[model samples]
Target: MFSKILVANRGEIAIRVFRACREMGIATVAVYSETDRDALHPKMADEAYNLGDGPAADNYLNIEKILQVAKESGAEAIHPGYGFLAENAPFARACDEAGVVFIGPPASAIDAMGSKTRARELMKEAGVPIVPGTTEAVDTVEDAMRIAKDEIGFPVAVKASGGGGGKGFRVALTEDELQGAFEGASREGEKFFSDPTVYLERYLPNPRHVEVQVLADKHGNVIHLGERDCSIQRRHQKVIEEAPAPEWVVDEETRERIGKIGVDAAKAVDYVGAGTIEGLFSSDTNEYFFLEMNTRVQVEHCVTEMVTGIDIVKQGIKAAAGEELDYQQEDVVLRGHAIECRINAENAARNFAPAPGKVGSYKEPTGPGVRVDSGLEAGGEVSPMYDPMVSKLIVWDADREQATKRMIRALDEYLIEGLTTLIPFHKTLLQTEEWAKGDTCKELLEDKEWLKSTAPAEAPKPVVEDEDEETAESKYLVEVSGKRFDVRVVGPALSAGVVAAPANGAAPAAGGGRKPKRGERKGGAAGGPDLVESPLQGNMWKVLVEQGQSVEEGQLICIIEAMKMENEITAPKAGVVEELHVKEGEPIQTGAPIAKIVAAAAE
Candidate 1:
């Protein structure tokens, strides 16, 4: 066992790894950027170091800074939790060169599986079924056209060779749309991953997003821990995940088959530690095709842990230390159904736009089979510089129905303030007929009206602040022997506070309270319907239209990259484009008019 391990990550995942290390009696170290000095992950570590300032590139993604911290903190190993440098092959190699263990698969494995095209080729060689398309990179739009028109037919997916988590991915449903999708995927690939190569895949419209969790050791032992159904997603990224695949989507025989496929995939790559083999599984056909491999602990690993009763993090650490298999394939058994909801600071009504702001009244639900992996408190802020995920709410029960009910209860009990969250969305989603029948709820997700229904019905009651500071603290103060002492209670009370409870028994809505302190935004000037306003805060990654350019109704006008997701702002009506306001690579805010349109003949 290692004496100390440095977690090269932040937020909930960092806290998760720390907890596992503590249970295993290993000292933990944490590194944080200047913006995250007050964050929870650093506060929980046995040792903490500052990793410079600003965005991830200056901090978490800075391999040298992270390595320096590890060396200074005397950490024996580095655990790159599932983001930032988690899948970076060079980081893994750097850890090895620094004489510190990288608690993951070897760099070779990461390199082998990191590129989507290369992974597809390897899977085909290993006899694992993959989505039909190019097994090689298509460098030009011309090649993409040829591949889509002749090789794979229509509805082809243009995927960045190094993409994951929905970035650098686009779908072209027709020949006319192929060039745009190709260029978009390549651009995002170059920007995010520094890899401009892309590949085509036969897009499986509305296929179930299933993945198998595999654990392997350096000593040639690999095993699968069943499957997780991650079909509930927005913007092609998962928001909810459930274990054992609902039993209806995956039968016992198919489960065994997919389990073997997962094991085989790991073996093909000579993989080590914990990894996930994501696939597009068809319930109607009882067949699964390989999608890609995530060479790190997944975001939804908590649901897997709840059912399997396996401390995957601890096992991963042991494997890195050259430990043997603790359990054979026969010993692994899933006990119950588990579901995980990614609680993000986002507004579902506004197309799941990121709503980064400070938290006010934060409280987690507590009960049997309910777990919250979070990093924020009542006063914490969800920074727009990172992913929108604030926490992961997981629950378990003997069956999917019971698990659904428990999740509903847990969601109702969770209270977050100051900003919007997906709680309202999750509440409505779990109660729908689609969930009961194991449907993906694609229609509802695509329906704008249906999404609006998931928004909070009302804001909380106003909390007036008129009393003087001394006067407010006077009542909370207690003094002996005529000695006056100051004690203060600020903000709204947990109950009967500013918040108004929802009619569906869900958590109270945000955006109500007395003026106390931190976190405010710069409102952007908005115009009428003809003006295309930015729906949320983000960077203007690209502007697709120029002044006086004619555009059709609902045509793409701009792409706003917010919280690692690209939101395409479109024309509201058929007209001549004018008043172009957004600049490329500039910060944009909600209601900001990026462009405008008038009568086409007027131009």
Candidate 2:
């Protein structure tokens, strides 16, 4: 076993790897950017190093800086935990060139699976089932149109060759959308992955996102640790995941077959360490097709760990150390069901808008069968500079029913006070009959009414009454000093001594005896036209409308990229763009006006 390994990641994943290394008696080194100076992972690791003072590109993704730190700290290996450089083949090769072990699959394996089109070709050659589509990159929209309309039919998916997490993926259901989807996918691919190439695949509108967790050693021993169902998603990003996908959908026969396919895929690349073979299981035909392969530990790997009783991260480290498989395929057993809910710092009410802020009062749930993998604390801050996932709330039980109910109970106890979270949304989702029946909540996620319904209901305000004697009064319940009490006041009106709970539960942090700070009033410049305010804080990726351009109601005005998700800002009413307050590539804040919209006929 290695004595020390550098964790080349941040947030919960880094902390997760730290814990695994500690359990195996291996000292861990954590690397952090300027924004993450006070992060939990750095504080938890044995030694820490600063990788300069810029965004991810200048810090986390700086291969040279990370390699320097690894050599300086004398770390025997470097573990790229999931995002950033986790699946980058060049990074893996660079680590090898630096004479440091990269705790993941071989660089060749990552290279083979790095490009979606190349992976499709390799899988096809290896006799692995894949979705029917072009095996080569589509260089132009004209070519994509012909491929989608003539060869693969309409409703095809335009995906980046080196993209995942829905970053460079778009669907074109008809010829009209082909060009835009192709261009968007390619642009995002270039922006996120430094690759402008994209490919075509037959889109499955109602398919289940299923994946098998694969573990292999350098000695050519490969085995699968069951599968995870990740169909419950929003914007093609997984929101929830479970292991041993409901028996109704994936039976023992299908599970074995899929598991074998995963093993075969890993052997084809001579893959090492932990990886995943993601597949799209048809909702109509019950057949599964190869989607793509993740060449590193996945965010949802904990669910599979809960069911299989395997330490996947440790196994990865051992594999990188040239160890042989310790367990055989027959020894592996699926014991129970596990579910993981990715709790992100976002508001589901407003299209899951990112809500990054200081965590004033962080209270995590704790009980049997419940585990929370988090890198946050009461006074920590969730920066808008990276992924919005606050933590992964994983629950396990003897059966799926118990696991679902336990998840509900656990979500209720979780108290993240400052920023808005998806706790209420998750609670509501688990309670739905469709969720209980193991049906992916795809339809519910699409329903705007249902999405808004996830927000907690506010208590009704007391009816105002006169101060006269025997006034018809309604009892008002309020919170005082962090305690709930029933105060029988003669009238609903506040007279002399009355206190209301602070917004976002921030009162307790304000000495628990004073009113919370007031927000600045929002009345913009006196002569300005109708202002188009930014809904959240993010980098303005694009400005769609030019000044003085006429636009209809709900017309696209701009796009803000935050938390790795794109949010489109649109015009509130029919108008002409008067003044553009901010330009493309500028950082904006919530409620800050980005443009001024005047009446269509106004001067």
Candidate 3:
């Protein structure tokens, strides 16, 4: 067992690993960029190091710097908590060379499964089912066109060989869209993964996203915890996940089969530690096809832990220390249903755009069957420099129905002021007809009108804007027994006709600063109906329209990259583009003018 372990990540995942290490009587080390100097993860660790300021490449993704920190802190192992360098084979090998244990699979295993194409090839040879697609990388658009038409057919998926978590993946519904999808996938692959290789696959229209969690050791002992249904997603990323996939879609028999498939895939690469085998499961045929493998702890692992009564992080660390797995296939069991909703700093009403900013009055729910995994606290900031996930709300119950009800209760109790979050979205989705019937809810997720209906509820403005005309009660400080107290005095003040006045709708607090307001729209006000405004803050990724160009109603005008998700801004009406206000690669603010569209009727 390692005396000290360093977590090479941030936010909730880092805290998660730290908590596990504490339980195992191990000291924890934390590293942070200057941007995260005061982050909760570092505050919770036994030792901390500063990686300087800048983007992830200069800090989180710098293998050498992290290794240096580990050695300086006397850490024996490093845990790359998902995302940045979790699955980077070179990072794992570097840890080996540095004589520090990497609490994940070997570099050989990561190399075997890191590339989507290579994983497909290996899975096929290992008798593990794979999605029907080209096994080899398609370098040129010409080659991709031929493969899509001659082999896969229309509605083909162009995916980066090195991509996961929905990045560098695109779809071509028809011949005209193929070239763009091909190039886009290749470009994103090179930019994100340093690989321009992409492959083709037949896109399943409404397949459910299911993943199985497996733990393996170097001693050849492997076992699966269970499966998680992650069908509820936005922009190909999961927003909600539940363990022991719904019985209606995946029965006991199907669960056992997929569980075995997961074990087989892990065995094929000699994988060790915690890993996830993501697959596209068909609700119709009850068949499963492998998507890819995540080589580290997952963001939604809490739901699985809640149901399985197993500590996945502890097992991963034990495996890295050359210990045999404690469980066999028969020993693993799932007790109850658990659901996790990702509480992100996003606005579902405006297409789930990222809403990163400081949070105020943060309050997480408590009581039985409810858990919150978060790194944020009151007055903490949700930096746009990182992912939008502010926290994860996980709830467990005897069954799916009760679990859902518990989740809703927890959501209602949870409060995060000063920024928009997905609480409303989760509350809305859980009660939908599709969710109740175990459907994938694909149509609902893609429906703009339905998404708009999930916007955060706001309190009505007080009718009397002038507080002077109001007779509302006011409080004043009064000393009592050497203690300070606030007392409300309204009787004589009302009779004396005392004028009242205040800037905020709610009276000021005892500390003097105003209580953080909710649903407050900042920046320039949106003007005329013909003028489209940016609904959220982000950088302009692409501007699809030119000034004076004609467009149909709801046509995509531009893409905004916020908190790592691309949001499409569309035309509000059929009109001619009179002017474009935002340029590509520039920062935009919420309510900032986007474009001016003169309605066709006026023209």
Candidate 4:
């Protein structure tokens, strides 16, 4: 076994690899960028090295820097924990040249699978059921149009050869849309992957995104760890994944057959360590076609781990160390159903825009059969440089039905204040009848009405009483800097306050309080107190207000960059800016005072 391994990744995955290494009594070396100097993975590892600037190209993806870190740390092996340089063939070969073990499949396998078109050709030659599409790269729009007509026919997808995620992909329903899609896909491909080569594929309109997880050892022993149904997706990105694929849809016979196919594909590549064979399953014809093989651990690997009770990371490391298969194909057993929900820092209501900010209250769900693989803490800033996935929530149950219920309950308990999250969206998805019935496909993207219906109901409006008795009532005056604002409090304890004044000058009656209810006040005549405004949670990227400055509504007060993305903090209403409590680049917890915005009196 290796004494020390360098984890060439960041975020949750790096932490995950570190945990596995720790359990095996192997020391871990973490590499971080300038932005991630205070990242969780660096703190968790035994030794850490700087990978340069925050940009992926300058830091995580820089092969020379990663190799330097490995050499400096005296790491025997380098584990590319998915994303960044994980599937880069050159990185693997470089590790070999540097006399360091690469904890993944052979470089040859990565090269073959690195390009989608090449992988399709190899899979076809290996007698795997490949999707009907062009086996070669199409350089021009004319070539794409010709191939769409001659080979794939109508409704063809133009995809980047080296593209992953949902980028560099465009679907053309007709001939008129072919040229535009080709150009757009090519542009994105070149920008993202530095590869402009694009390919065409026959679009399977309503196919389920099903994939089989496989593990192999150096001795050519390969085994499939069952299938995961990832039909629930948005923008071609999987949102929810379930293991064993709901016995009714996959059945016992189909499972065995698919498992065998997965194993064969892995063996064909002489693959070692953990990988996944993703496929698109047509429910109408019950036909499955090979999509692409992910050459590294998948984001949804947790679901399979829950069902198999196996530590995949440990197995991956052991295999990379040239170990033999410890268990036979028959020895592998599937237990209860498992499901995983990728919790991202995005606003589901706003077209799923990335909502990167400070994590004010980062609370994860915990219970029987519930597990959370996260790299965030209470005050961790969600940076915008990396993937928006904050964490993964995986739950297990005896059956799919129970698993769904448990997942919903877990999501309810999962709280991430300060920024918007997809928790409500996940909760809505769990309650969907089609989801519960296992009726999902890629076509779910076209159903905007169905998607909108799953959103949570808006909060109820607060009711206000008459303003006459409000003047005589005791009012609390909270001073935020030099600005003073008047607010009516119902209870004796100021913490019991709830509703802020609505735009209509009506003081809404407070509902439930931390303590008993008190009387209400009218206006500034009632001697209202002033209060300071602060960011919900996140590092204080900048302080926009000074001691005394008149500010209007919708003014950009500060900018908080979390999870590698920037969030603009705006003024709630027209007020005079008073005291600025925070400075730039300072980490602030949830409810930390940011500035004081004193409300203007009625004219």
Using lDDT, give the best candidate's number.
1
Q: Mind giving the per-residue lDDT tens digits that candidate 1 earns over 205-291?
A: 989999999999989999999999999988888989999898878988988999999999999999999999999998888779999
**TM-score to true structure, per model:** 0.88, 0.88, 0.86, 0.76
Cα lDDT for residue 94, model 2?
97
Q: Assess candidate 3 and give its TM-score to the true structure.
A: 0.86
Residue 115, candidate 3: C-alpha displacement in angstroms: 0.6
Which pairs of residues collide in candidate 3? Answer: none
lDDT digits (tens) for residues 1-603 of candidate 4: 999999999889999999999999999999998778766879999998876775789989999989988888899999999888999999999999999999999999998988999999889988889889988999888878788898779999999998877768889999999987898678668867789999999998778889999999998789989999998887777888999897777987888888888988888888999999999987678888989999999999999999888888999999999987677788779999999999887766544556566676678999999999998877676776676888999999999999999999999899776656678888887887778789883344456665565454652122222333323223566667887766543323233334455444677555433322344422221112344443334556556676688788888788665443345677777888765667888865444566767886679
* Model 2: pairs clashing at backbone N, Cα or C within 3 Å: none
How does each model score on lDDT?
A: 0.89, 0.88, 0.88, 0.81
Residues 105-201 of candidate 2: C-alpha lDDT, one tens digit per residue: 8889999998899999999999999999988999999898887888999899999999999889999998899998999999999999999999999
Per-residue lDDT over 214-325 for candidate 3, one digit per residue giving the tens place of the 0 to 100 score: 9999999999998999999878999999998888888888999999999999999999999999999998898899999999999999999999899999999999999988
For model 1, name the residue pairs that clash.
none
lDDT of 2 at 257: 90
By lDDT, the better pick of 2 and 4 is 2
In model 2, which runs have C-alpha deviations exceeding 4 angstroms? 458-529
